[model samples]
Target: MAELHGTTDDRNEGDASRGVDRTLSAVLASGALGHSERRAKLLRYLVARETSGEGDKIKAYAIALDVFGRDETFDPNSDSIVRVEVGRLRDGLRIFYGECTDPDLWTIDIPKGTYRPTLTPPRVEPVSPPQPAHLNRWALIILPILVVLPLLYYAMRPAPAPEPTAPYPVLRIAVMPFEAAGDHPNLEKVAFGLYTELSLDLSAYPWIAVVSPLDPNEIGADYALKSQLLWQGDNLQTNSQLISLPEERLVWSKSYSIPTTVEHIQDTQLQITSGIATSLGSENSISPDLIVARNARNSKPNLEGFLCFISTYRYAVEPTRTEHLRLRNCLEDAVDAFPEFGEAWAALGVLYMDEVRFGRNPRPGHDSWAEARAAIDKSLELAPLRNAPLMAGVVLSVQAPVQDLERARQLGRKLMELFPRHPPTLALIGSLISEFDGRWPEGHDLVQQAIALENAPPSGFFITPAFFAALQEDDAAALAATAPLTTRTSETELLLKYLAAARNGKTEMMAEQRVLLAQKDLSSDADLVEFVKNRRFHEELEASLTSQLEAAFLVKADE
Candidate 1:
């Protein structure tokens, strides 16, 4: 590699020094980049090194050791604090100066794949996009058993059933007596049949408990499902409404009309049950009947482990008195109960990251990050399917402090080949598309494929497309991507709205969402992440939002 050169003594050194100082001051003053203390330090450290004529001495390892406080044996492959921060700093610098800094002033850059800082006078020419910061030649694909494991989960079992009384308050549904109105002969039979089907379908959800022939006093459940049946000409019409208990809030209501035949009743009930269960927070595509049947005959040890794994997965993503203890206990219980549960180990790796990511690890008695890293390694060793561990590794690779991007990119390609149309597969790789790798086209395509694959994907599925659009400054595309989430009132919904409105210069819409965010008590990006109820959505969204927040599309509105 060529050493970086500067003409300090020969070419306006005093003026250049003053220009650098002025620029650094502007960068640190904005909420755009300095919100992250490490980013600010990275910029300052690089600028200082350049000013002192020590740019050639700057290396990835040195930055890792000196600025980021890494130890002597810092590994570029595993601990990527320096790499991720450098990438952010580069992007932030462009966005900050593009919006706030003067055009005639100096432009400073620490180019990708190197730590050397370059300072140059303003030029009118357009610069080519920088390369990805940690681009390494990806290792050859190693097909592992974890490949297509998400598909295997389809074959494994349907879903959840435990005592309704767990420590956590679960979503509950009480299928009240389906009333038959006027000329509704054999209506009781239809109502009873629908009740049985509803009970079975709703019970399949891991977080949902069902109460049959619900009594009025069952206030403990979170929600209640009620319906009325009417004969509409040559058809049976089932009108259903899901209501929140105690609060009496209308969650969702729908009407379904199908032919009054045994075949239609059976098939239509399944469809309606599936729809209702989904609205109640079950995002898994598996039908409720499948879940009910699977849990009924699951092997004891495996079932115990699976239950703990699902619970841990839930607790990790969504915030709820969340301190990482409950998730840790759940994963520990899974591995202790069934030592062969590799998915549990993979999830444990994510939870260990939860400590560092969420401030759960301050001054640890143990090396939690190392332990977390080992968990994924063990998961890869033991997992019968590769997708679970591979996906977990992909998440770790995405600016997560100890990122493993090359390995993740390799695994992502393998998973993409194995399960092209799987929602999870599309969701994972699609969210990772970046200008850095020139993968945004493929990434956006995958997200679109995922959207096409599922008729009713979760609200989080729209997130990746919207994010990619925002970062690219395609405000129209960003608005188009978030059209699906407009009806819902979620933290993510509010976030996308704020982003779209802010980027589109829809000042009134932006102001409206800002109020909604305050109502949700989400004060920061971290707060928005904590409110994430979807794991796939959270990891990918968190990965991109940091840089997106620093980009030029958004305007600061009057408070």
Candidate 2:
């Protein structure tokens, strides 16, 4: 590392220091680096350390520990998190200063191969010859008029009406009465039964409103789920398709087949209905997919409130500071515009809880917990049966400072009884019990059932199995369980792979996992421990896993 060098005698050190401070603040506030909180924090930390005369001692390990929350076990040789962030920081500073309006602003730079940041005071520009005295007077007179005319026009003009708060129209899905291909006496009854069952099952989803026995010309429904049943070689076959009503486009289609028998009749109905509900309404389902797709091309203001749900869904998938702020603002606006929108309130509650968990609070003294509890309360009061509010209440009960695991369990039981066919709900509650409460076999069974119910299971459906496998010390089973998530780079996926590899003595694979884990902004073993803690696991499992990881990876906690 290099020490800070003194500037030339052209300006006093005090002037240079003040200029650097101003420049740092401007860059930090600027949007040149997009909204990456990691890069912003890195920039601020580096500048603060350099200015405080700690530049020479600013090693990668120290940077990781202080800025990135790494523990003492952080090994600069193995972890590239510090180096990768510094590289990005260097590029971001170049772009910031390159597009700067004030070319004379002092800039901070982390030179290649060194963690120490160098501050370069802006060079003095050659002075232009003074304008003529009459030209300066005329320019001063014109400039005031230019500014005052705009201000006076604004002051004189009538204030426009506030944009009407358009109610967020929940996406409506109508389950069309099914048509029968065969003329069996029971076929019409079976088709009607399927329609009724499917509609009732889909109503459990919080994201969409469900309607049944839809008329083909229904005006309000956004999507139509049409199904047809027939006898195929002594088996009952049900075919279904989801169509976007406005565009009349087929969004998704599927067919399910089951043995034809008196006992199999209800099971067949359940099979087809669970598939449709999971495909259309579960997490990572077609509803959010359609909303995101449409919102990409359409920028009308009416749907902004509607898009808040989509923002929350996307943020849950990939949590970045930018996404968090965007979702938070969107949800806030949504609730403010329509206080009675219980779903939006529920989503807002979830967002607040996330702010607490992720440490993404917008400012000091934000009291995210209080905000979450209030939002949850309002949502429950308004939409008690809605999934979002119910789930939010369940989550808050467990995670808040005054823990209520029993209340969470009660809410989980209520969800299970209410929405037995809802796959994501089942998986979530199952995983919550298994991981948070350490109820192993029972919770694991529920997740397996959820998997069986889903046509296209999400990665979350497999997490419980992986955890179970890891606990059993069956690394191969754990790896196989998480195979569907091979392409994902989430911290959970990396941690699972690391655990599997480390436990099985797979040095080559463990090293590969370490390389990726190192890039997750986690500097040491304790950082991973904190990540696990954020998952809100049961105390027993958390302590056991922490110890196992420490021993398996040969990493020590910071003293």
Error of 2 at 504 (Å): 1.2
Q: What is the lDDT of residue 119 in candidate 2?
A: 81
**Candidate 1 residue-wise lDDT, 51-125, digit = tens:** 776887788899988887778988976554565456546645654564553675677776544778787755456
Cα deviation at 208, candidate 1, in Å, is 28
Candidate 1 total steric clashes: 9
List the candidate 2 regions with Cα displacement exceeding 4 Å. 1-302, 360-362, 555-559
Residue pairs with backbone atoms closer than 3 Å in model 2 (clashes):
none
lDDT of 2 by residue, 265-300 (tens): 545545555665555544333444323211011112
